[model samples]
Target: MTDRRYTLSKNERLCGKKNIQELFNEGSSFYFFPFKVYYSFNKNKTEGDHCALFTVPKRLFSKAVDRNLLKRKIKEAYRLNKPQFYNIPTSRPINIAYIYTARKMLNYSDIESSMIRCQKKLADNILNAQNDEEKN
Candidate 1:
């Protein structure tokens, strides 16, 4: 069973208008069905692992309840799959924002699977970046 400590805390949430703007402006993103993941490596030492922000567009999800539900599901999925990414040997901390792009709310299973895929892809990306730097 996943420990309670592994659960996302307030400190693990990506915040600040300036940092968010930079992340959107400079980060690379990829779509995984209902989610669009934006990520970039942060070399600063504030956090050892990654921090995340979850977003659901108001234009797409008009109801506050619907938007909140999707947000909860997405967070749960990420919380479960985060261990793999955390275990990947890397020095730089990563910042991630998961933007919900789908018009409709997807089921939990779908969200979980997508989150898993996103984590694996993210790990691959980190590995590739490390390899590229080593090659230079």
Candidate 2:
């Protein structure tokens, strides 16, 4: 059987214009090197079922092929490192957008490393926020 943990299933992809708008409107964000991460908690979603969106702006990559390649790289990185993000203790599901901010193409290894770092940082940020709220 294929390992589900490493797969990026359709349900795991954030879709629909309304959902996208809500994520950008209400989500909190952070920048880590080549990516800008935006995330929000979804109270209605099932546990451990986070959704993510990958974006490569047209302004930076005018060619559709280039944009698609970058997006694929980003998605692969996320799929591989997703289990780490799941380790973060949370009652609600998370919606995330990983917007590629780099002007040029980067090696897959570089993108993967940055993705790992971003995951760790995001986990720490979420834990800190949860702790802060609990104490207040």
Best by lDDT: 2
Task: Give the whole-model CA lDDT for all candidates, comma-separated.
Answer: 0.84, 0.89
Q: Write the per-residue lDDT of candidate 2 for residues 106-126, one digit (tens) a residue.
A: 999999999999999888888
RMSD of each: 2.5, 2.3
Please, what are the lDDT tens digits per residue for candidate 1 over residues 37-119?
Answer: 89887746545657799999999989999999999999999888787777787767888999999877789999999889888
How many residue pairs clash in model 2?
0
